[model samples]
Target chain A: MGRQLLSILLLAPLAAILVSLASRRARIAEYATVAAAIIDLAVSIPLLLRTLSGSLIFAHGYVLLDAFGVWVILCVSIVYALSSIYAVGYMRLLNEEERLPTFYALFSGFALTMLLACVMNNAGVFWIAIELTTLVSTFLVGFEREAESTEAAWKYIVVVSGGISLALLGTVLFYWGSSFVLGPSYAMTWAALRQSAPQVYPPLLLVSFLLVLVGYGTKAGLAPMHTWLPDAHSESPAPVSAMLSGALLNASMLGIARFLGVVTGTSVSRFAHAAVVGFGIFSFVLAILFIVRQTGIKRLMAYSSVEHIGVQALGLGFGGPLGMAGALYHMLNHSLNKSLMFYGAGNAMRAYRSKEIKSIRHVLKVFPVSGILWLLGAVGIAGAPPFALFLSEFTVLRAGIGGSYRWVVIVFVIFLIIVFIGFLSHFRAMYFDEAPEGEIVPLPFTAWRTLPMWLAFLPLLVLGLWWPHGLWNIFHQVFLSVMGGGQ
Target chain B: MFLAHINSLQASIFSSLAILSLLLTFVMLGSHWLKNYVYAFAAQSWLIAALSASVGYFSGYRELYAIAVLTALFRGLVLPWLLMRIVSRLNVKREIHSVLQSSSSLVIGACVVMFAFVIANHMSRQQQGAAHVVILALTIMLSMKFLGFLMLSVRDEAVSQILALLVLENGIFLGSQILVPGMPLLIEIVILFDLLIVVACFGMLVRFLVVHAGTTSSRELNRLVG
Candidate 1:
């Protein structure tokens, strides 16, 4: 079951890409991606069920699921399934036919690489997979073939690639330190690094931690190093942007989490915390500032990622159950809300063919379902009541102040308001004003697209309104296990 | 003792050979000719290969020979050949109206080279290794590209821009190659692949600049500045 399930996750996308190569049948290509997504989503369901029961299937060495990997993978698969469906309708409107085939293939490639990255237990393997995702998605970011798109892709590649390079260097240095503890023969597995942290060389470990923090932090879209996020996210197709903002960023975050777990020994954790705290506050403030001044819908969301990643890193840095849970929950909530927003924004882009915020208005009058969904996503992301993000954001704030970082809490509250306003400014322009001066056509909502949205949004509504015990157990187990007996 | 003195002198000679390649980087900053820049880059790679060979002897790392030979073949031979083909096709002469005057560019080049030395010096204080030396050497090469970019940004010629690009590749190859043992092999290969793709993309950028936009230098970066 372990081999089969893992093979299914990895091979399904390759199969889709293989089928996509046969004839220029965009219909078949769309169906293939959607089918691949469904298969991946279905596979993740059993894993999720097992995880929720506090019985996760770990196989292929450390590559198996405990609680944390289970939820993170499930989130990725769910988003992948939805984004593929969204892509079908999204691709139909593209003006260029020449790059469509490559785009479809690359999208599948990105999913395959990200899935492998999410599941890998070995740190080196995980880092390589994340870097591979960057490579595969570069073309997607540049899918439009415009100079701005190319420039965005170029900047994304150079910045992230360089950052990941530092990540590699950091990984090597960390492993070099880990060698002293584990006796150099053992591979640098996540379990080994965490389990054997006491013996790791403190000074070497400190350098490694700083390197990975800066390197992966940049890829995670944290501030001071987040120069690539807005342009890359805003310039790509809305669905591509969705995957990037929703899922890819999280995978990198997960890698950083792995780095944090092992690197933060009792002696060196303070250094890690200081770096995380400094960058987290800076990123949150910068994201708010950028979002407040943004004119483009996609660009606004990109900056919002900077904010969310800040929250996530801050939670990890705080290092307790409440903080970790809030961070994990925010990860999930942001994934759902951001993907939904991108889907809605995809529709708006189709209708208006413009990403400019002012040009798109009265989307509810033109497209009722998408406009409402977009509003819900925006509100959910802004930490509206009963939404998981509200719980996560609030808990994180409590963690910050309880930990005596009152200034962080203040900044967090203020930025939350700024982001909320930025989102609402677009939402109001989108749904409450005059109808857009653009053509309104009934979009090609492939069953893939519509089904996933219904699956995703309805559950979001339910979860926001009530708490599920099974999920609570998943987080509880995660809090107990993934934290490695730490607070 | 006699043999030790001879080896030290040999090492210094090998390093001085490499030093000439680093000097080649500066020569391009003040120099104007495309042929001169390309020739200088080729010489830079040869010196890098030679320096690696010297390090190999000192460290007794046998694999450095293969690396040295590969550098000569790929960097010194194939790349320069490609650049010559491009140079002949474009029939470009010299870069005069570059982004900066030779005097300013020379000054900026010195500052950048000094910055590279400082970074190298600081990093060596942490843990001394060949990696630091290689990174600093590459930094010098990269500073040339940065200076050339300032030139390209102000200058108006596709050929100069491409020459600047070739200089940039010298830096990348040095950095990527030297990042070894400290960096994973996968990353080094990926960096190489990135270099190749960026070259292709820049190739296309140059084509568009020349055939469509009627400008090749980075100077035409005005229309989108808002």
Candidate 2:
């Protein structure tokens, strides 16, 4: 039954894509996509429940869903489901109804591919699914048919496809090395590799892990390979930006984390840890530098996505129960928080009719509710108190200090502070600064638009204040699964 | 003993074909004509197809024969023809923009091959004979991919960059063939089909650029900076 549900979760979106194409009317396409997203969420609920009870590993060991994968699927579906509402509002507001059919088809297709990527336990299947995400999202990124959109899409495809092709080579290397120990029968299966990690040649494993890191790391938006991210995110439509920054990056990170899981308990674990930690730290620091200089509101949010993903990577690299749990929890928190922030930014852009941060001012005076929600989102994302991101960041910091990485923790705190100040500066200017004379032409606002923002933030606040018992159990199980029963 | 003798012959044939493929990549680097670049890529695919077929004959893996046929049909014939149609439609007969002089690119390509030989030798020092040759082929594929990336970064024409992407994909295919010959045929076909779709999308983008922007030069694609 669980396997059947997973298939439905994967295949329903293809049906949605066809339904979207079958209708020429934009309303039909739009409604069809939203219906598909809701069905995806309904399917994921049972799958997550089944996973929490116990992992569902079937399909000849190729399809495995544990606590971590289940959580990723849940969060992705939630974001997609909610963002479909925002997509309806924003795409219509943008008034490009002619593009709706392609948009809806690619939208659901992208979601389906991401879900497929999360479920595949075979490394080869994993890479193919992730590559499909890129191919599908390339069209999504280029949906607007403008020069900037097309150019961003081109750069996106080139850079990400290049990075992931390298990942495929790494998968081959991994198979070649693992075949020596495990034979060809069970080679490249994540469960098999993790079980026999100690028997594999250490040097071969090390090289393969490094290659996979660079390959999947690029897709996950880890710097210094993150050149295409800001352009693609900023140029894409608001809902796509939310998905790319929120859900898609997590799917790719799940790819990297799978390899990380396999390489654990081997001599090369430390090397892989160092590499992930180093990339994470670099991404965090570089994001601050870029965020401080960014003028576009969407680009500002995009850089912050880089920073949060970096923080999650850093937490996982710290490699203790607390750290890995923190990283997993942080993934969920960041997805909601980042998607909320993008939604807010989308509203602000629509009201002001510009993405330039400085062009629109006195947001509080014009759109008071969304302006506050947007401000709270920035605070949450910047690791302020009373939000889930702050709690996750604190947990990771505690783990780093407990692990005797005081210097790294200190540096991490410094960068977090810098990012906080960077975000505050932009937020203050946008919200509190005076609008130019006659620039306060406020567009009419609606509750449906801000409803998703409230829905996203409520749980964020609840989780921050009190970690629910069920979620804690699930997160702990996920932590154990990732650390391979405490390493 | 008979199978072993045939395998030895297969190894030498594989080595020579691998070297020929590497030379064709360099030929692509030195060529100024877009048509020549496409032709060189197609020829390299033919060599790879032959190598796969030979591997199948020796190993008796029928799936590899299927792979060879797919490679020949798709990479050897269909892709180049599609690219040629796009080229004719765009009316770009030859490369007008050069990022590096032909002689310098040739030098760089030679260095890349030598570098691969050195690294592959050191990495596979324990392996003997045909195993070493296969490892060398893998390394050469990596080097060709690196060269393709270099061309992609430096080339100005969108068409040339697309060609560079094809070279990169070909290099990956060769590496996979040498390293994981037992990969599921499902995945192999999916990768090939993905290449087709990506190339088609890229071709469409090139046409869009030509029709809208009046040139297919990626250098003009600077309107989306930071």
Candidate 3:
């Protein structure tokens, strides 16, 4: 049953790619992708529920459907579904009817690679999957074919490919280290690495882990290495930006988390955690600085992505059940909330014919219902209460408070307030500030545009209000599987 | 472990091939012409393929022969061919905009090699017997990586950047051949094909860069900023 669901979950996107490519009309291609994304989301939820009871291995152990991996799959599928629906409304605005088929094809292909990256069991194969994601998404990032878009695409591929080669090297080192214990011919599976971790030389293991962290951290948009992100995210069409933030970063984080799991109980574990914490804090501080002085609206959201990814890294580096749970929860919430924010930003960009926040004024006058939802989303994403991010961020903070990095918790809280102020100030200007003596023309309302925001906003509100018991159970099981104490 | 069991002739053969490949990376770093970078890359790929086949022969890993053939066909031949096509399409021949002089960059590249050697020396100290070959492999692998990044930072042309990325992948591939020859055959093969797809994608993007951006040099492509 689990295998069937996994097959369907993967095959749906493959089928969508074929159908989209075969179709001549833009509407058919768009609808086909939306259908595929919905099917994937439907399949992934059950897969996540089923895998929580026990991990499943398939295809000679090259694919793993464990609780931790399935949770990431769930996040990817959610973003895929939301973004595809949002893309239907968003791409129509681009007026490139002839190229829409190709766009949808690459979009589904990008989704397929992120999903593939989630379930890959072999570390080497996982690197390939992540690399494939970069390859596919570079086209998507450059889909607009503008000067800036192509430049962003160039930087995205170069930086990410260079960064992940470090990950490839680290994986080789890991396999070499394990070879000393498991012979020269063993599979480089996550389980094999974990089994051989304690026996590998401490210095080798530490160096390998740090290399992998920096490599995957670059992909996941951690600071200092996040130079490509604002350019790529802000320059891509909005739905693609949504998917890049909402799906792709989480997949890369899955790689880092799994690697952390392998070295969890080793002698280098403390140093490993501290290094993660250091990167996390650095990313957080850097993002805060950028956000405060940000100009472009989507770039604001991009930097916020860096900030939240930092928080998730902080959670994972904290290394307990609570920390893991909070990080996983933050992944889902950030996906939903970031997608909502990008959709609104896309809508405003189309209506006002500008990408600057200063140009978009009186949002309630323009969008009315969805505008209110966007405003609330901005508040929610700023780590305000009655929204899901606040809950997850608070949980991550609680996880840090009693730990060795309690000082990081204090730093985390202070910046949380700063981020709250900095992020919402842009929204405040957009929503409440008067326009500079100009009549802003609003675009005609489409359910395609606002429906996903409503879909995303409702869940963000509910998940904040009620943290589900089933979710707690799933998080606990994933924590056990990732941190290595349960069967 | 594979290195420990190999005889001195095997070790020397591996060491020389590895050093030659590392020298090719230096040729890439020191040259001003984009064609030289591509040629150096092709030579380095061929040398790594030779290294892979030799490692397979000495270590008795038969699958690496297949890997060697693929690396030669794809990395040594097809990738450079594709990159050469990208270069010929562009009007710029030599790196017209230099972030650093070739002489200075080559000096920095030497320093990077020494730095990689120190790290490799530290890492290989943990291993027993035949440690020098492991150290050599690790050093070449890492130096290529550093030199690749150096090329990326110093050269503004799109083709040069693409070659730098290929150099990075070559470094990893060369290291994996020596250090983990028994890594799954499927993975190595897929990564080879994956590299082909990457270059093809880069080829298309370079076309897009030329058409849409009007310049392939990143110095002119800087429209998007925070």
Candidate 4:
């Protein structure tokens, strides 16, 4: 059953993507995504239950049948399933006969790459998978096919391609350094590299950490190199923007976690930790500045992505159990809140044909469900109490302050406050003003569109309210694995 | 010190030739005609390819020799030839408008070269034979970046910007070969593939700019600025 499920998990999305290409209508392709997602979830369910029973499943050398990847893959598949259902309702409203099908095709293809990036055993293949995510998403950024979107696509293409190139270079460099350890057995697999890492050249490893930090961190949209984030996120389709903010960024973070694990070993771990923390503080500072100045609703959310990613980076930089858990938890919450924000943006624009903050007035009046979701999303991201983001974010901040990184905690609090004020101003105007003049009628609001959002949000609610049994242990194993936990 | 001298001498000759091509950045600022700018770019590539060949021959790295020849053929000849056709057929005159003053840009070019030389000197002290090579190559990269930035700053011509960008890419390939030798063949091939596709994309972008905007200038691209 495990072997069969693994093949299905790998092949199902590719099959859906291939079928999506031979047609103009997306109904069949969207259904295929839903089917694939459900099947994948079903397949992963057993892995989760078995992991709980203290048994591990391994597919290939690189593919570890561990609790960490199983949980990530399962969560990704579930969210994807929900998003697929929503896409059916979403695409029914689009008039681009040729493009809508292509959109669905790329969407499914993105799911395949993300899932592959999740479960792949070799860290090198994992980097390639992350690069594939950018390559596929470039089209999604320019789906509107306008000049502005073209510029946005170029921004995404150039920055991300440049970033990933550095990552590839870093991976190869690591191979050169690690070849000293595994000799002819060097496979570029995570397990091998970690096991043989003590012999890893320290100076060379330092350089590798720098390269990976800049490379993967750029994709993760850390500041100083995150110039492309706002343009690409704000310009892409709402759902695509949601996925980018939600899952893609997390995937890149996972790449960084792997880099830290391999490079640091059990020793000082100083270089990787210092560099990531610096990047985190820098991102937090810049995200607040950009968020306040932004006029586009989607751009505001993109900058928010930068800020939240900073929290995750801070957690990883700290490298303690609490910090690691908080970082992982924030990954889940970020996907939920950011995707929800973009859905509201999508629905708002569908009704108003504009993303301008001033033009999207009275969202609640026109699309009641999306309006409330948008409000909740805004509140959540601003780290308002009771929302899931508040919990994860608070833990991150607590970790920082408790660890005596007072500066990081202070800067974080300040940035969160600035973004909160900015969101309030925009959120107030969006819900209270007169219905946008000349707002479009008959926008698509399929019940399926709401499923992914709800699925994403549900975990946030559950995690925030109660400490789920076994989650902590899974988090511990994953964290330790990153910190070279268990051999 | 003897080993260092040889490296410095090698780097000096290459950098001097590179500085000679820094003239092209000025030409970009001062020149009016698109033809002259493309000519300046062509001359820069020719110098770059030649310099790369000499560096490879001196270092005895045969693969770099192959890369150098490829650089000369594709960048020196192919890219310039392509740009010539793109401009002449597009019917845009050679006397294109620019963003900064030719004199000022020339000054900036000199500064960038100075910075590159200093950086090259410091960098050369680290690697056995490749330090000067690395520094000059990095300067060439900065020069390319400066040239592209200048184009982006002043002129609104999308075609010119894209052309300058390809030239800039030539500078990057030049540097990468010098600082990072012994890389896996796969990476080398991937970089080459990436550069080729990017150039083709630039070509397509130029064609589209001409078709849709009626001119390849960014002034016409004012449709999306915010």
Best candidate per DockQ, number?
3
Clashes counted in candidate 4 amount to: 13
TM-score of chain A of each: 0.93, 0.97, 0.99, 0.93
The i-RMS of every model, in angstroms, reads 6.7, 2.9, 1.0, 6.1
Give the alpha carbon lDDT tens digit for every residue of A115-193 in model 1. Answer: 8787777777777678778878877887776666765665576567656656765676566555545552355677777
The residue pairs found clashing in candidate 3 are none
- Residue-by-residue lDDT tens digits, candidate 2, A1-487: 8878888888778888998898867998888888888889899988888888788787777788887887899889988987887888788887788878889999998998889888888888899899889889988888877778888888898889888877887887787777666654353678777777777767767877888899999999999999899989988888999899889999988888888888887888888887888898899999999999999999999999899889888888888777787888899899899989999888888787788999868888887887788899889998998999999999888878876567888999999889889898999998788777776666577665778898889888988898777776786787677768543
| A131-189 per-residue lDDT for model 4 (tens digits) | 67877887787777666676676657655765665666566556655655555224567
- Best by the lDDT measure: 3
Backbone clash pairs for candidate 1 read A362-A430, B99-B154, B99-B155
Residue A413, candidate 1: how far off, in angstroms?
1.6
Better by DockQ, candidate 3 or 1:
3
Worst 10 residues of 2 chain A by lDDT: A179-188
TM-score of chain B of each: 0.74, 0.92, 0.97, 0.78
What's the TM-score, to 2 decimals, of chain B in model 2?
0.92
* DockQ (model 3, Cα): 0.82
**What lDDT tens digits, residue by residue, belong to model 3 across residues B1-226?**
6777767898899999999998888888888898998899999999989999999998899999999999999999999899888888886789878988889998999999999999888876534557888898899989998999999999899999999999998998988888888888988999999999999999999999989998888888778777
- Least accurate stretch of 10 residues (summed lDDT) in model 4 chain A? A51-60
The TM-scores, one per candidate, come to: 0.81, 0.96, 0.99, 0.79
lDDT of 4 by residue, B28-146 (tens): 65676778878887787777677667756775555666666666777777777877777777777853455566667667666766765564354233445644544565566545555
